[model samples]
Target: MGHVFRTEQQALALDSLSRFLKAEVEPLYWHDYRDTFVPKEKLLPVTQQLAEFGLVSGVVSEEYGGLGADWLTNAMLFEEVAFTSCDLALLVLINSFGAYMLEKLASEALLERYLPGLVNGSRFVSIAISEPDVGSNVVEIKARARSTGENYVLSGEKTWISNGAYSDVLICTCRTSDEPRGGLTHFLLDRSEHPYEVQNIKKVALNSQSTAQVFLPEIVVPAHNMLGEKGEGLRNTLALFERSRVFVALCAVGIARRALHEAVHYAQERVQRGKKIAGHQLISAMLAEMATQVDAARLLCYRAAQMIEADLSAEMEAAMAKYFACEAAVKVTRQAVQIHGGNGVTTDFMVEKLAREALILPIPEGTSQIQQLIIGRALTGVNAL
Candidate 1:
């Protein structure tokens, strides 16, 4: 059981959050809006509410108006959120990580300007890394940032950026030099000060969140806006990924858990051949498998979270969690649909949306394939990519 890993405080926090989400957030996501983006205006109210429990200002220390909850606690919170609404969970995730980045790397002035709003959820933030030609390969990033005296003139495009359309601040990865390893740099761009363009990309699922292409054509960012040391973006980003991949895995676990619940509930109620489908051997077997997979995925995610909390290197464990959990989500959700029979493919059922949402989990954070390579590289001590 997940309770095996969580502390009493963490369990209590998750319980409170579970009730809050059910009463306050679930209606907005499931009853009012489905298969469409909740406008930023509506979403902000929920995010602000989440900040009360430290979901928004994640990893930022309490001195900065953040809860400074441990990563394991945060993982539990987000997993609960994803169970209620994966789309909303993602919006919270990007803000949380953005706040963490600012707390960790931003200059005092940069922190003063952005951290408050990000902590309170009034401002949204995004990390821009993937280019049209680059995914999972940070060294090959093509977005260019040229020094111009006191400022850096940035010009490039970033695709598949979550929160791109709504970001108040963007931690963008840019190629500042020609060298492969040290070329990459991180710049903190305020949307109001350094304007850029965004075009929202439509997708198969998670439509309630923004996934967009960000275009920066010679946007001038002050040198002070640079995050961390220059030429250290790749190293910094990789460090973040070691933990982030675990959170992403938890999201997949949440989706699978929901699908499993839906299938079990449906089987108990639906009758086939003069008996409840839950009584049928094949349906029962599917239910058993779904429960096992969901718990297994949850264990892996919690293990990775524990490692991160202990400040251990979880590069290999994180990759394993992400790869296993995301694939489990796809499999479990498909099985949920099959258990629902004809109704599963229809919009009237939540399983349909769960299935669509599950499909997107393996793509972001890192593709399932990329996660496998990371795991393989860890095992063999050889770089496959």
Candidate 2:
């Protein structure tokens, strides 16, 4: 609940990342890949660059090829990444959390096998949880991994899987039992070894990133590929969600902040009634509201991040931050578009893209409705979901 200021190391790292973005990634993103899917070949280099700053697989310990930064520091770096490119931010997020889970749950040999490529960004990873039928209700997952002799036959369809098409490894959630919450388990599936199918799913925004349908059709996975205990998937996943939701909230904040910047820049340059629109009372008021909302949302995200770094259970706080920030992004980006007037809808400007990107924020992590239900459960001690 206390305010968390950035440490000197985090500040320097942020500065370095900002410089790198402006100098290298920004030009590349705008020049060739803003409106289309960024190829894995192009993305891997940037991922490796990010790894140098301890961001690609951040939050894992230094002993296992990570920076060992705290959650708040990682959140700070993550927001900066999102500001430059939300698409890349999502990729970094998947890699970071995927590595986090690997470090926390994988056996020593498993970690030894995967951690090197992941840390260096030579390999891409994804966490497959959502399915064709399952959304917020994780217990309803039908993806099953039937045990056999020293191997499990995995069969399931995981949809809305980020990095699915590009992933070399997947941390897939599967149903290993029929005991509701305890039935879910996670499996580490190597694409070369297990051979699952993937098809990219096109979307309204953030197309520079891959969102795909992953089909695991009776893939043979060795028993060693099982992540954690058989029934501990839900608990580990929920724990990851507490921290991951905060990072998602920060992504929303970054988008809104960029939108605000665009609006302010446009308002000051555009003339209306012989004066800059920024001087007009209405435009000024709208800018004020957008700025205020962005700041408030960012503060909420940081609060949740701080709580997570302090080793606290941030379920309710994470839900609150994710709910408020994502909703605020929708509002803030729309206002940015309104400020841009007729030009807002055109592809010539970046505000339109920001608006489109913001639209996707409220749905990921959890829907705004889901976050509200989580807060409701926290406050009333009643399970709303």
Candidate 3:
């Protein structure tokens, strides 16, 4: 039963999610209103609908009002959403990540206060870690949190924060002490009551998602809002990375698959030299390579998901999956553009959007270079970064 259960249940769940995406999301892909930065009104209805299906909190524990599905199931759901819109997928993904951390590390009182609204999609959350001077270097952040008797005063700036403008709560990392790696701490900030401000940033891609520069000026968080134990934020953040990398890899897989699918469809329909472009060996070779890489990325992503579900040490595996999937997605998107020729560069052709979105995958979650360093350190027992 375990063998059959694994095979059939997983397939059935994926099939259902794929159908949902086709019915609800695919039709909206070409809508004139779809943008990288999803507006609050537009995002609220969609998120509410997804909440009815328990998607927003699928990874959280069932006791906390989530589906409590395994990591592979969540990965499949992420892939399906990406096939529809990467921006929407991100909107949901960031919320899920914040909720997962709160469930795992926050005090029970904190969980009771936040998890319900988060799971029901009534509230949005985002992580604020990247700073103007520190994009991927968590240890070097200058954001400081000073204890002031009854509360902590947080002062600093965070740039490139996803969902920054719209999020109701922010799980932010700040330096609390001067213990180098151990000095960092995580705080749950209620943006509504805080003196923080968000300024949207324009970008070359991912224009539909809200990426912003966040400013905090003596924002006071209750002492109870500290996640985990004081001085343990760095360690907790590292643990969160294991799960975050898997989701990022899944996003890469979805983006790559969609790009390849569009390119193949174009090749089969467009006639060049009195035959379909797909019939030409050059085009066929490109499509073939793209298909192979997409499959490889999917397998690696699933393997990493499985490792996370099995309670194994997946740091190296997660890094490898994210690195390979993101790089492969970039390659696939570039080839997709080549296959479509001039049409690929225009907004009318979806491949252009895919290409733009693919460019950002390597830089988010963790950069491909950072992934390489993680894997290097894992294999060589030497801290290369």
Candidate 4:
């Protein structure tokens, strides 16, 4: 990583996004989840605003109403968005991610039909890859999509998916063949065409727009709906994951920054031993470590994002960024809680909530353990996962 977080103009743009989060998203998004569901009324307005923001537009071509920026710029944008609310950051992320994979690999016809809607935020889409039996192992997917004469019968259940409850379009990973690496295939299907069940997952310390389980039981889709060539599902998905993991790093960057901000503020005003806590040597040391670690995570994300922009495979770089950044976030947030003392676990303090949210970071995209496996392979030249 060049250690450059952003260009001057990009920094200004992100500053503007930070202001938008404080004014528009912070009040409602931070505390609004219905049981386990995020209300559409809250998500809709912000999503529509995001449509005009060009984060999602960066993935598509200028001919298709996108900014067409490099993947690194999009990753930076996600970092800023994550600072506002991790749940809200995911909305922008899903928008861009689903759009990116489709525009890159799906047919021209499919792009024409959905890019406008997706880019404009008229419709929501999500990538469906994880299943009950499968976590980081993409090849072990039990979801099957058999091609019939004119259509494919899709039957499977996907869990831990972003936007699973509300997305109208699902970029599904399905088993298309029995071949080793090429057995899986991608499909861009309209959920309206096939009635599927969705159950919102209840979780702890989660900052997600919406998380749900999608049940695809004997659903049918047209032959044209298949994304890319048959038997390339895992390949396409891994390619996307290499980039997506960088965004996961940025997500940690945003979250860790917020935790640092809250802790610094609280420390300055908190009195202990007849003095401000921040004046204490130990408290200042903790703050210094947090700032340094957050910067390191951001730099790693930038390096991975740059690799992606250069059209590199970037599996090792992405895993390193994702693993280190997320683990750092958990550590940073926990320390932020320690700085808050007994109030750290209460609803009155943001650090308590932020700490809880940080707990969810090491699980999504790929667990910290999975990222270690990927990194271990690159270092030792041995496949670990």
Residue-level lDDT tens digits of model 4 in 1-385: 1256568867886677778878887777665551245667667777777666656876777987888877777777777778878877776778788988888887889888888888877778888899999997778899999989899999989998888777888888899887858899888878777676778787785534677899998999888999888888887888888988888788888899889988999999999999999999999999999999998998888888888888877999999999999999999999999999999888877887777778888888989999999999999999878
Model 3 regions more than 4 Å off: 1-6
User: Which of the two, 1 or 4, has more lDDT?
Assistant: 1
RMSD of each: 1.2, 1.9, 2.6, 2.0
TM-score of each: 0.98, 0.97, 0.95, 0.95
Top-down lDDT ranking: 2, 1, 3, 4
| Cα lDDT for residue 277, candidate 1 | 98
User: Which ten residues in a row are the worst by lDDT in model 4?
Assistant: 29-38
In the predicted model 4, the residue pairs found to clash are none
TM-score for candidate 2: 0.97
lDDT of 3 by residue, 1-385 (tens): 0011245776876677677767776666556455545578766767776765556778888899888888887787777788778877787889989999999889989899999988888889989989999977888889999999889999999998888888899999999999878898899998777758999998777777788899998898888899888888888888989889878887888888899989989999999899999999999999989999998888888888889999999999999999999999999999999999999998878888888888899998889999999999999999988
Candidate lDDT values, in order:
0.89, 0.89, 0.85, 0.83
- How many residue pairs clash per model? 0, 0, 7, 0
Better of 2 and 3 by lDDT: 2
Model 1 per-residue lDDT tens digits across residues 1-385: 2335567777888889999999998888888888787888998888888888768765789888788888888888889999999888888888888888888899898888899999987899999999899997778999999998899999999999999888888999999999988888999988888998999999999888899999999999999999999999989998988888888888898889999989989999999999999999999999899998999899888889889989889999999999999999999999999999999999888899999998888988889889999999999999887
Of models 3 and 4, which has the larger lDDT? 3
TM-score: which is higher, 1 or 4? 1
